[model samples]
Target: MDRQPRQSPDFLEALSARSQDIFRRLVERYLETGDPVGSRALSKMLDMQLSPASVRNVMADLEELGLIAAPHTSAGRAPTQEGLRFFVDAMLEVGTMDETERDQIARTVSGGARGGRVEDLLNEASALLSGLSHGAGMVIAAKSDMMLKHVEFVRLDPERAMAILVGQDGQVENRIIDLPPGLTASALTQASNFLARHIVGKTLKEARQSIRRQSERQRAELDEIAQRLVESGLASMIEAETSTPTLIVRGRANLIDDAMASDDLARVRQLFDEIETQKGLLELLDDAETAQGVRIFIGSENKLFSLSGSSVVLSPYKDANDKVIGILGVIGPTRLNYARIVPVVDYTAHVVSRLISKKGEL
Candidate 1:
């Protein structure tokens, strides 16, 4: 059964020190073994003079407060989603990555140090995170604010033409647009020249605004067939580039481990469905872009993973100007090793941001 809704922070603070200690031990034990923790098990781990019966009484209180639950009639108690959230926020101590982990991350990100594309760097980082965390790794590629270096139009058919945009960063993008009827090849060449003159050294958004203003004031001068082609071509290319952020995911196979497949196949299937329909994931990443540092979403805390009992740890990576550009994260079961994974994610974000800042130099 799903856990109860989250209680207020006041509820956590109201617990006695002894009760809090017991709760922390219980949650930690469950996270380690993926099973419920009995009072006998918790008593042995505690330092106080609490017997098994005393521990049982505390566990009972924790249960009534909706912090933990017994999965079966005779089984030990496990922390609910609310309990896990409390443990993560109040009791968890985040640790730094070891030398080996640092070296591995660095190697993965800089493998193409001889000058790789930004897309390649992000893909490598995602794959590395997936391998290290044993969870699905996700990355949103940074949006281009690249200035146009050149623009060309090539007619393919009677009604279609290809718009080739070369950016100042050496990145090339292409889009196909519908040609205005009764337009000649000479008109296409004029349209390409007009766009190149106006948009070179300007970002796509800047070019769009400039075109809009020119269209409004110089309507008579731009009444030719080439002007219509320029307007339609630029509009289509800008919309295609800025419509939605690109999402890259790796290590989805890790989500369906033998234990998950056998014990909770339905939840696994649901998780797969959630990944397939990535609107929820994109929205979650967008929310992370607004926040600083690592953002953790445990189970029902975010509605996207409410039924799947999943967790996501996301961090926003920035550019040279310290603007948040994209997000990267790991997704897995709620019992992921937050202490270890949090530092890995935080470090990876730092590395990615530095790489982005150096994109022009590369």
Candidate 2:
């Protein structure tokens, strides 16, 4: 879906208390059952005395304002994508999770992290939110900005070599790189030695820049074949790192369970198929990371999930210094319970931040 302008506050302000209450009830019921709601049903649900005809008239005004729409000619009305955004922005009432829910999350994250890596803790967060929300859960595995301790090239095959990067914290990552044609064992050794000599102690990005500058100055002194190998190893690894930050996804089956119709199931399947390659969704999470708190992207508001008509609720986790490092959230149909999930995402980030602070101080 193409981006539409954000909903104006004027629309909400113009609505009467009755109109707002009726709209609120409609959304609540739709969220509960994933079905369109008729005016007769809404009429009975309203606390005030109003006939079904009166309720339908109010719904007509809402539809005209682009907040609601009838999905079928005969069926009742459902919130439009715009209506969901409007509700989320203006009408949603968020509540703190009770002690039981909080304990569940705490147990899941804390139990999973007992003497485990921070990555494992965050991965547990993904599974926790997916299980709670019944949606696809995800966490953006922040790239290690820790300074590099060592970098080496190991030949795995005649055609390819692996670039292994070890960080100061002892975290290691390996990227497979294509070998330059006719490259020799001696050239590989020279390249590895040059990288360890110059690129060690720099972040991956800094190491990349360092290679370019040092290579230019030492071109005449450096072996030509070794230079090619060094460039290839750094370039390949950096490209791979940027294109695919480790996105930990869990509980995709919940999406199928959430599907309400054949078309809904098909869209969920499309989402399942494309989600593996959705490198673009990172940009949306990046926006959330830079923001102050929890962020919500309704259907079509973010282009990557527009096709599936899904919503995302994201919060960035921080480290000891409270710097936002990575994002955690759930993706499901636009009708997801935003009020319930928003606080969960927010508190989960807090939990993760505390976990990191403890480990960092240790």
Candidate 3:
């Protein structure tokens, strides 16, 4: 469906206490087992004090109300999408991350160093989250929108030099190129001088493109040696494709486990397919930029996640300037323990924001 049908709270207000209890149990069981729950099973386990016949009748009533689904010819029932929504909004008990978990997450996200780079913080955060969540963890690096601080070139030979990038926010990246074939150290130095004269204050794409046009028009105006270095250096820079945001994902293998039954293996395979498409993954997180605290997109609530039967819990991390630099979160089955994982995801995002802010501090 392109959009989820809007559900009114009135349906919840109309449920009796016993019906609500039964609905909660069925949803919980489905989440834990990924199977339809039968009325006899509920009464046998929970001491619900209701006969199987009465429970079955109640299940029928719930099915009629659109809170549960009964697969054809099955005595058991599963929660419909509306049923999961009701459980999340009214029945689920939200929990908080304990102090110990928070402390560890804090250390890992901040890199435990007073002045570590933003890249370090994000890398560590991704690892820590994946290990803890036992699901795929993800982070998008801070965007490059800062003023240029400094630029330097390290000459390797007559033909090759390495461009060392330094951002105003303390991020660093390196671009290296082969020497055009036989230029002199003097020619390389001359090319560096040319770049310094034009490149110190612009973004990498801006600098590379501008340098290419300059070199193209005036190749004959400069010595052949300087011309070769400039041509090679700018060519190497263009090949870098450095403008796209960096995506870090870890622990994808954890998605398959004994918890997933043999018949459900197809779903696991589908999930891996989704992972290979980063554009879809980015779209899934786009709402994070506008969310306050933790945002949960349940199965099929989002198109990108529909086929995977997965849910994403994400929070946006901001830079020192209060602009959102990136997002941090986990992706797992819809059966995830939302009550517990929600706090973990929310708090980790907060820790990441603080670390990013510290790294970006002027």
Say which candidate scores most in lDDT. Answer: 2
Looking at candidate 1, what is the lDDT of residue 346?
Answer: 86
lDDT of 2 at 21: 97
- After superposition, candidate 1 runs with Cα above 4 Å error: 1-8, 72-74, 112-114, 150-164, 174-200, 209-223, 258-262, 280-282, 360-362
Best by TM-score: 2
State the lDDT of candidate 1 residue by residue for 1-362, as single tens digits: 11122344655667999999999988888877777888898999999988999999999999998899998775699988878888887788788677888888987888744454667778888988898889888887555666788989999999999999887766787889999999898888878877888888898779878878874565454547888888788788877776656778889888888336438767767877766676565576567666768878898777767778788887888888888778888888888888778888888888888887887533
Candidate 3: residue 132 Cα off by (Å): 2.6
TM-score of 2: 0.85
Give the clashing residue pairs of candidate 1, or none. none
Task: Return the TM-score for each candidate structure.
Answer: 0.83, 0.85, 0.74
- Tens-digit per-residue lDDT, 110-192, candidate 2: 87578546667888999998988888888886665657789888999888988888876566788889998888888888888
Against the reference, the lDDT scores of all candidates come to 0.79, 0.80, 0.71
Model 3 spans > 4 angstroms off = 1-10, 44-48, 70-74, 112-115, 146-193, 196-243, 258-262, 281-285
Q: Pairing residues by index, what is the TM-score of model 3? A: 0.74
